[model samples]
Target: MNSKFRALTFILFMAFLRPALSQSVENAWVRRPLPGMKLTGAYMVIKNDTNKDISLLEIQGPDAEYYEIHTHENIDGVMKMRQLKKLKIPAMDKVMLKPKSFHIMLIQIKKGRLTKQAKKTELTLIFDNKVKLTTETKLSKGPL
Candidate 1:
């Protein structure tokens, strides 16, 4: 192949690689929950930049006693929640955790104090590869 032809082919390959290289977590935010509510849900979209499957293993927060991965399903016309062992996100895809769906269950609020006053709670999401992503979430009042 000529030098000009080879250079054009290389340029085309690099153009196709740009989108994959730019993949990242975008607009990751969770709503603040109401007071007296023992549990709250987190929702976010994860954009997979690479060509590999990612599994979300766990989520944790400092304000709660413990956190667990959960999914809401309609079984026999009744809405029920079950513990999720792991959440899987396909390559170049997005996973959304929303109300009445898959979500992170934050349980056991600290005693004797309302959640509204709490500050600087760290939400750590652990992936299957042991990659931990932390997001700071604030508590709010009202139903999610």
Candidate 2:
């Protein structure tokens, strides 16, 4: 191959490969809210496809006043939720957020808006590398 052609090919390959090797978010979903309750939970899968670990800085959305990254801790047989400053996803590993585990807590829902039925909501996840991932989740009524 010509030198110039080879150089151009390398550049193009890097451009496409960068995103695949970097951190990414996948399979993000939120639990349905309970009837007559303003509080709900969100879950997602964070995958660090790169060779380096990534830290999730924050989570935000329009439905709640404040979104917190939290984890359920079992203290003396009592499970309690606690705020987590940051969530770490190891390199080439996947972290699953589920009920009674690490989750995103949506607090202080805006009043006067109906949220009893299932609807699609958008959430912005901020990472330490300044990458923002916008994911859609279906909001439904939680178990009664």
Candidate 3:
């Protein structure tokens, strides 16, 4: 009976602690799209500590008509960008959303917006299980 009670207590403790351990963000930023271009990409490092995998379902904007999770694939020695329905961040690990790897594509950007002059922006990440995490991203016009 004592062992059973201890197990139950452990379960309850982990449940309450899960949210605190769920997600953390690092080095989040948006790369300024080329002049007059309709698309640009954002990069970041997402760390997850929970025991379950988390799926990044969507990215909400500081300035964009829309967003998509995308990755570059090498096909026949040629690289192409493809949209992902969702990007998964593995449990107890981190995912780097970087240029030509995995990234958030900001589409149909508002003209003259998100320029380096703007300096910074906020992006709200919506994950599976309805978890939303918002982070400020620097607006940059440089490599990686």
Candidate 4:
């Protein structure tokens, strides 16, 4: 291939990777569960610093046996949690996962995972472009 064509291809590839590279997870925290409770919720703000949109595919972590993206909606005057297949983060914007809204459901937490000294959990968020972001979230009593 010619040098001009090679340069154009490189530029296009970089552009494709820009949005995935610019995305970041901020202010992530998992609420402390009540005694004898094995389930809890986590919240965070996903910031998109790029000029293009991005989507979150799924989440995985060692703290819990199961993790799901969930949101609460009012159904017939009753609010209930609903699982989401994917969450979208708009271009140059932020998506916040908070209580009574979009958040992460952590089920069947690992035994003794939340110790006094270890007050944080590591979560890996997978995106549409196969980009994985590993973030450490501190434990909290409520939204900060």
RMSD of 3: 3.8
TM-score per prediction, in order, is 0.74, 0.78, 0.82, 0.79
Candidate 4 deviant stretches above 4 angstroms: 1-21, 75-77, 115-117
Alpha carbon deviation, residue 32, candidate 4 (Å): 1.1
* Better candidate number, 1 or 3, judged by lDDT: 3
Please write out the lDDT profile of model 2 over residues 39-134, one tens digit for every residue. 778888888888888899988888878889999988899999899999999989989888888999888776743265546788899988888988
Q: Which ten residues in a row have the lowest lDDT in candidate 1?
A: 20-29
Best by TM-score: 3
Report lDDT (Cα) of residue 15, candidate 3.
Answer: 85
Q: Write the per-residue lDDT of candidate 4 for residues 1-144, one digit (tens) a residue.
A: 699999999999988876454889999999888767899999999988877888998899888889999999878989998999999999899999999899999999888885555688878999896779999998889945
Residue 28 deviation, candidate 1, in Å? 4.0
lDDT by residue (67-140, candidate 1, tens digit) is: 78788999899999999899888876878777778777777766643355554356788887677777765444
Displacement of the residue 101 alpha carbon in candidate 4, Å: 0.6
What lDDT is obtained when candidate 4 is compared to the true structure?
Answer: 0.88
Clashes of 3: 0
Error of 4 at 54 (Å): 1.2
